[model samples]
Target chain A: MVDALSAVFQRPNFLAFVIIFLWGFYIMVTRYNLVKKLVGMYLVQTSVIFFLVSISAKKGATAPILLSTTDPVHAINYVNPLPHVLTLTAIVVGVATLGVGLALCSAIYRRYGSLDEEEILKRLE
Target chain B: MSRHFPAILFLLPLFAAISMPVVCLRHRHWSRPISLAVLSSMVVLSILNLNSIITHGEVRYAFSGWSAPLGIEWVADGLASMILVTLSFLGLLALVFAGPTSPKDLGGRIVHYYTLILLLISALTGIVFAGDLFNLFVFLEVAAIASYALIGVAGGRALFAAFRYLVLGTLGASLYLLGVSYFYAASGTLNMADMAEKLPHLLNSKAVVGGLLFMFIGLGIKMALVPFHAWLPDAYTYAPESISPILASLVTKVALVGWVRIIFWVLGAKVIVNDIPVLLLVGILGTLAAVIGAVLALNQRDIKAMFAYGGISHIGIILIGVSQGNQTGFVGGVFYLLNDAVMQAALFFLAGMAICQYGARTVEDVGRIGKQAPWFTGVLIIVAMGMIGLPPTGGFFGKWYIILGALEANNYIAVAAVLLSTLLTLAYFVRLFEAIFRQTPLPSDRLPSDIPFAYKLSLGATSAAVIMLGVFSDPIVQLLLNHALPPGL
Candidate 1:
């Protein structure tokens, strides 16, 4: 348990990811402005992407690209390419989601003439 | 050509969705027929694919000639093909039912609407066929974006509802992706079958458990299971008339299929049910949703809101079946999934027609519908009866099978909850019936006889199906669902 705790502390990157995710979630839950809520959502998405990317990183590893000069590429010498590829796909999905979200927000704004979530709900009620 | 069935099934609607606007610009009247042609072709392909799966064993198609486990593959075993056929057929019927617009004021947006509808269908098809987790996420986003635009196209409170749905739906998708990342990190593969192979070995790993939890919560929100169901009522109520029926029938149902695949296939039921409390938790949540959804629905004035809440209640029943984790329970759950798709689509189509015919939005307005449009009201009564689980409706058998499964599992609470929700369901739908048949008259719009014939035919077809499905359920149960499900449930 102590070793696990020390390991977690040593890897602050993982801790930061968790904190950022929670913070984004908090904003999404509490914020009344639609734009802010969407921003929170984006933060949450990016944090997950970062966490996934971090899992593929090995200390002192080079980029996934092979160097012919270094002949005979070793697995340990380069970062794993799979997570990068996966996250790249995820990033594109995230951006598409964000674009759609912003478009929806703009539509909401045009209709209600305001972007406050609670205010809109109150009016709807 | 047969080998390319999966690609043809998904790509047809996709290319059609893309070209809809251009087709509309050239000849406006051609857009709807073009969409119908694409969807009809997809239905034919999916049916052929399902037939192949049944006659043979599983049908597996790898994209770009890539091999399995390493390359993405679309495999229709038992379950996936069943859903593929149901979703595509429902989509085709709903598009047909949408009929031609008046071509007056609403003419401009008709092309866009059909485009989004076609895109949504394409996304749903892809979601069901995707063998890789990341591929599922991509399709999920595509579906989400299309639905958002579809909802907002109605242009009023629908915009707000779509926005709210977007926020929650995006959050759900992100959580699901994050969960996939954990699995990928642990198993070094995103293909579902590969993940399943690795999952048993990693049962004790915290990352695996965390991933499961994240996915469960994410999918629950997406499916609008209790406590995460706030957005569904409005989204369903406020969406464009033509779009609601398709979304009602297919969207959440496919999402549930995704959930089942992840829990029972990818993660393994033994790990999910034995190693954790997910089964019990879902069962309890389902019970809560069942009761709460029915009670909330009882108070709703808007017809669509009532159906949306009722949808939540039925989802709970499906959860109970899954929690049982026995063959009978899986069968019951899968059967209920099929029944709900047909019945709910029927109900929503009736609701849309009522709104178009008389601008009927509430129960009071609906009361007048019966006196004016007897044919529409008659068909609606059958759907309502089905919703309330009356005999000779497909719904009754689904509940019957579920009750038997619950009894077999010795989960009396689930059994009791199922029965109680039935009563609650009857209570609410009966109120609608009373308003339709018994209530005093009120002034309402009476649509002219010029109302499109296609709308009535669609409603008639689905209503007839509800009864036929109940009577001829044995063949379907033996053929489609029994084989469709993964073995050893």
Candidate 2:
């Protein structure tokens, strides 16, 4: 099994993909409540983030620090930091979306006086 | 430097979005022009960008002059450009609809609304343009955040609807991001074209299937594919009349396009067409949404809410075409999307006219006012016929192509669903028309006596577009299909 997993990682970008997408699936399908649902959703989005991050990964790569830190410009063995950077922006945007959604949820709870979907629908009817 | 204007077109909207609140901080009324100017320029820019891509085929620009996989890339392939241009036109039409039918306090929220609109547009444009998967996620977040807020802004039932959307939308967004992460790890390249180049090497792997499944589920929420569409009806029903067109017109289309790009391009034909159960999932789910949406819509009292359900049903029909993964099927889907957005926007706007002119909230109150408002009803009928997919309207063309594609694809059940829904869709809207137009006006609207000419002009413009796009679908389809269809299924 370890060999299978290691082999999956060796033949390209498989292991990283597995870990992220699975984690996302686990979160989204399992969560029930509204905020929890959002949490699950965020977990799934992590698969996308991981997918992006993994693309920039090299077999023996490290943090993508600048070349000048070593007092030599010839060597740059850093992992691709671009996906990480992209995810950062995505993360901020995601947080803003979460804030808006939460604000809306609070308002819904106030107006309809419930956070449960069944209860809300029942009251709405 | 000059080649970068299309990128700037999107950037301008985002920048303006950030500045809009500040600009409106003192003089709130000024936000409309800012909104108008942003939309007008976006439309113009989209047209130019679309023309370039169609005539030229695939215009890609690197951020800060960096190469793909190493640097962020912006792509103006035919597909994205088509979606962008159509989105722009729809945005303008929705704003026009909003300007007339919505509450007067609209201006109070103008700064925030327009800012969100511009930001949403900017993000959608980026999603289309981004050659990289991570960029797509980022753009999706930008658009999604704006939409979640826009849904809740109207208050009342809107908060409930927006809350539902937010929860579901967040789940979907995160899942999509997770899928992107997986794809990135496997491929070592975030660029879509690069992934296509690399994915074949990792074929028959569980990780690929895993990634595809995650993406489908995530995107499925946005596509509102039957079982996953729990958030759609409420979100659409409760959003302001002004925002409905944008929500109904652009939101789902963007998600659908993203789905196609990722599923077909990133995953490839073998995976989407034969492997990984996409066509089957799409077909089954699409058929269900089509049937269910129309059935539910048939029973609706609120015209907007009914149309919202009808819109989802149409999405099902569209997915059937798209899921075939054939060029013809895909092209038909795009055409269907183009027409549906326009026709739907027009009809919704007309509905808005009723709500604005009278104090009426539901369809039960739209009685005999057609005689009082002859022009409104006349435009309404044109838009209605468009929804019915009648002759000389874009809506008809939308149905015709999809039906044709379904038949060609030998998806008889899907084709049947499309045809059946047309009658059902017509039945509800026509009933709406009769309720309002058929009765003799014994009473006038309790609200305003006359709607402003500006609103009418915009409504008329959208109605005209419905007719024009139908008659000239060939050129429009040609523009959309030329670069929209990638090589192979």
Candidate 3:
């Protein structure tokens, strides 16, 4: 139990993943403001990206870039490049999602003049 | 050229959608024709691909000649090929009906309208055929973004509805990606077939189960399965008339197909049925969705909202077949999905037409205009009977197969739910029919006169196809059975 506790404490990324994900979930479920909900979604997305990127980390690894001097590359000395590549694509999609989401929220605000969920519901009714 | 059918099927629409604005600048009248041409070519390509696949086995096209497992691949397996053909074909019919119906409502933004639609169709095609998890996510986002823009394009309460849908859909996609991250972390691969091969060795891992759960919930939201279906009704109700039929017919089905692909193909059915309790949960959810969807639909004032709830109920029936996880159940599930697309498209198309013609929005508001358009009303009754699973309609064969599958699995709960929901479906649709045919005829000036030739052609084709599918379901059932399970299941 002590060893497991130390292992968990040593990995801050894992803790960050849990905290940020739950925080975003709380915000999304509790906040009724439209823009805030979008922000909460982004927070959740960021947490996932961070978790994915962190998975590639190693204790003593450098970047996966090649050099003339490092022709015989040691696998243990290089971090995985695939997750970073995936995260890049994910980040691009995340930006697109935020842009469209914010546009929709703005459109809603223009018509209803409020971003609160209760207010919007009353107006819709 | 024939070998390039899969790539061109999506790339053509994507390129055309990008150039649609420039085309609009050159000639505004060109948008509709451009969309029609794109959809027509898509239909042809999908049909050709399906035929080739049926004859020559699965068609695997690797991107840029990198080959499978190392680079992106597009696999037109039996399931993917059949659904792609059906989706594009239904999309073409909806496009035909859409053009004459909602030009005034869309203002001058019809170019953007067609652009979003083409993008959506392209994304859906990509999703159906995508062989990698990351590729699926990208295509799913493309579809979601296009739908978000399309839903709110008219700028009214639709904006609010679209916003709500975007929030839910984004979170769902995010959760799914997180699940994909776990899968990737566990197996070190993103190719679905490769993952499936590796997953069984790691079946007992926490990451695999967690990943599957996240994906299931994410896709459940996208498929609008019962509890997560809050955004469907308003979004369908408020969308422009031209857009509703296509969205109603194709979107949720594609999402469900994606979910099934992941569960059966990526995770493998052995894990789902033997190693986990997921099938039981799915069965329970299906039963609940069946009863709840029908009951809620009965209380809906708006015709579109009622159908939206009814769509939920049908989804439940499809789920019953899926949860059975056997050959018979798989056949029923797959067949029901195809039948629902036709039945729902015809119903929505007819509703759009009736609304446009009579200026009616609610169930009660629809007067006895059926007398004015007898042929259209006849098609409506035929499609409605199909939804209620009446004999000699496509819907009956689908439900019958599912019931048989449920019995085989000894899932009496799902069987009871399916039977009860059929009765509920009958109750609501009968109410709609009575409203349509029994109401007093309005003044002569209120009657609709100019039923477009395109509307008549598309609606007639779908209605006739529904009947024909019911009568000649044996061949289709054979086709579904032959390819019901992925290899090694």
Best by TM-score: 3
Q: Give the C-alpha lDDT of model 2.
A: 0.75
lDDT of 3 by residue, B362-459 (tens): 87775466667786678878998899988898799999999999999888988999999999999998888788778887575466577789888889
Kindly list the per-residue Cα lDDT of model 2 for residues B1-489, writing each as its tens digit. Answer: 336756787888889889988888999878777788778888888888777766666777888888876778887777777777778888876766566555552435766788888888888888777777877777877788788888777677777778768767777777776667666666767788888889877866666677777778988887687788888877877677778778787788788877778777776654643354667777788888888889889998887778888888888878877776566777878788877777677766766666666645567776546667776778878887887789898778767777777778788888888888888888888788778766766643434556787677778888898899888988877766666776666
TM-score quality measure for candidate 3: 0.96
* iRMSD of all candidate structures: 1.1, 2.4, 0.8
| TM-scores, one per candidate | 0.96, 0.88, 0.96
For residues B1-489, write the lDDT of model 1, one tens digit per residue.
Answer: 666788888899999999888878978779888988888888888899888777777867898988888898887677888898889889988988777422321335888888999999999989898888888888888988898888887677888888889889988988988888888878889998888888778877777777777887788888899899998999999887788899889888888888888777776564554445566777798889888888999999999999988888988888887777677777777888888899889988888888876678998878876667876788888887778888988888878888887888899999999899999999988888888779656554545656677887788889988898789877877775557666456
User: Which one is best on DockQ?
Assistant: 3
DockQ of each two-chain model: 0.79, 0.56, 0.84
lDDT of 1 at B469: 78
Best by lDDT: 3
Question: Candidates' lDDT values, in order?
Answer: 0.84, 0.75, 0.86
Better of 1 and 3 by TM-score: 3
